[model samples]
Target: MNGLSRLPRLYVDPTLVPTAQKGAPCLLTPEQARYLGTVLRKKVGEQVRVFHAGMGEWLASIAEIRKDRGGLVLERPLRAPQPCPPLPLAFALLKRDATDLVLRMGTELGVSEFLPLVTERTNTHRINPERLHAIAVEAAEQCERLDIPTIAQVQTLPALLGNWPHQTSLFAAIERLDKRENTLHLPTRQVQEGDGLLIGPEGGLSDNECQTLLKRPFVVPVSLGSLVLRADTAVVAGLALLGNGLRSAPVSSQ
Candidate 1:
């Protein structure tokens, strides 16, 4: 078989909770068993690629297949674990579907972390971290990324700003660019590691909130364009621009 036609890739726990090793049978969870047996219909000798968030990716072979039970014998390592760039996105909480879209697309775009914030104009503070986490995992699996972005708990804008790290740079998306004298223009420098992007609620940040954010030396107000954009649209556009910038910047040792 050609190299491209090899086994399917899957994410699994690396600890081998059931105890898996080279030449040893590694038990597959019931969900995994159904996926391989019923969904993929793989035979006993079929190859599979498995990876863990903590451990690296591996090449394994199907040892057995059954409706309720299945196993894959570990073979060799495929790739080593790599660290994701520290590009964190802090967005004000939106409605359910929009919020999910941000997490899904952000993961695909290589965002390292997600911070759900509650702003002055935010409509809701209720967020399900578990659901968002699942979305991130699915996105990473589809995008073939070795690491999943960390999803943080929902925090108020003030609380988020209060504990903001010292070294990280913050880019705040604002609506009224005409008001600010020092607005960040596009094609500005590339975003390095430890940089953050912040998007406001649907109606945008309040006057008082904007003032508060502007007072911080670390925060930089950024404009999307002349036309108004929806909260979700702004996220995709902003990440695309920032992702491109990150790709252009020279790799840093730190």
Candidate 2:
């Protein structure tokens, strides 16, 4: 059997304060306890794979199981803490189901961070951070990801653009293209640590908004083929291309 397939995976809250040594007792949060004891029916002595966003995955054994609380004893380290490739995705906020899909699939696709943007064409400005966090956690657990993607608070597109970092590369998926030659080519060079991909809202960015984005030196307009893709679909396709490129390129030591 594959090594990761051997044990069930669980994402523990780093705020719970787990020590990084064998025989240390790691207390579970109420929710985590309920999940292990009730949902999974985990019993004392059963082994589990546990991980935190700050700390990498570890092998742990169930030490205590109670109605409202549970504990795990850290046994050994599974994977060390390594930085996720800097593939931050800035996407215009979508409707409930569509937003949920992006959170789940994006986490599985290994996006390091997620930025929810309120664009000119966006329908809703509000996003449920708690719900999105839960979705990312569940996706990470199922996909065997070492860490969950950080979900930023909802911000306006203009604000996001204003504060955009200089070192990070940005690729925007544009819907309008007069010629095939106008499509921005995927980076043939090595991807740096903090490259980002941006996708507009479902109805697409307003003319003024598109013009504003195009004026930015860091923003490169890319096309996701000739057809117009839904907001969620564009996220998956864009991240898929970026992820492949990042994985293929050799990491720079500088």
Which candidate comes out best when scored by lDDT? 2
Predicted candidate 2 versus true structure: per-residue lDDT over 1-254, tens digit per residue = 26757677888887664567778778887887888889889899998888876678889898998878988999888888765777899999999999999999999988889999988889999988888999998999998778889999889988998899977778888777445342354343345668898999998887777777777778867768888899999999999888877778786678
- Give the number of the best model, judged by TM-score: 2
Q: How would you encode candidate 1's per-residue C-alpha lDDT over 88-203 as one tens digit per residue?
A: 99999999999999999899888898999999889999888878988887788777788889999889988888989867678888887677644454334347777889999999
TM-score (all chains, Cα) for each model: 0.87, 0.91
Alpha-carbon local distance difference test for all models: 0.81, 0.83
Instruction: Show model 2 residue runs off by greater than 4 Å.
Output: 1-6, 179-190
lDDT of 1 at 175: 89
**lDDT comparing candidate 2 with the true structure:** 0.83
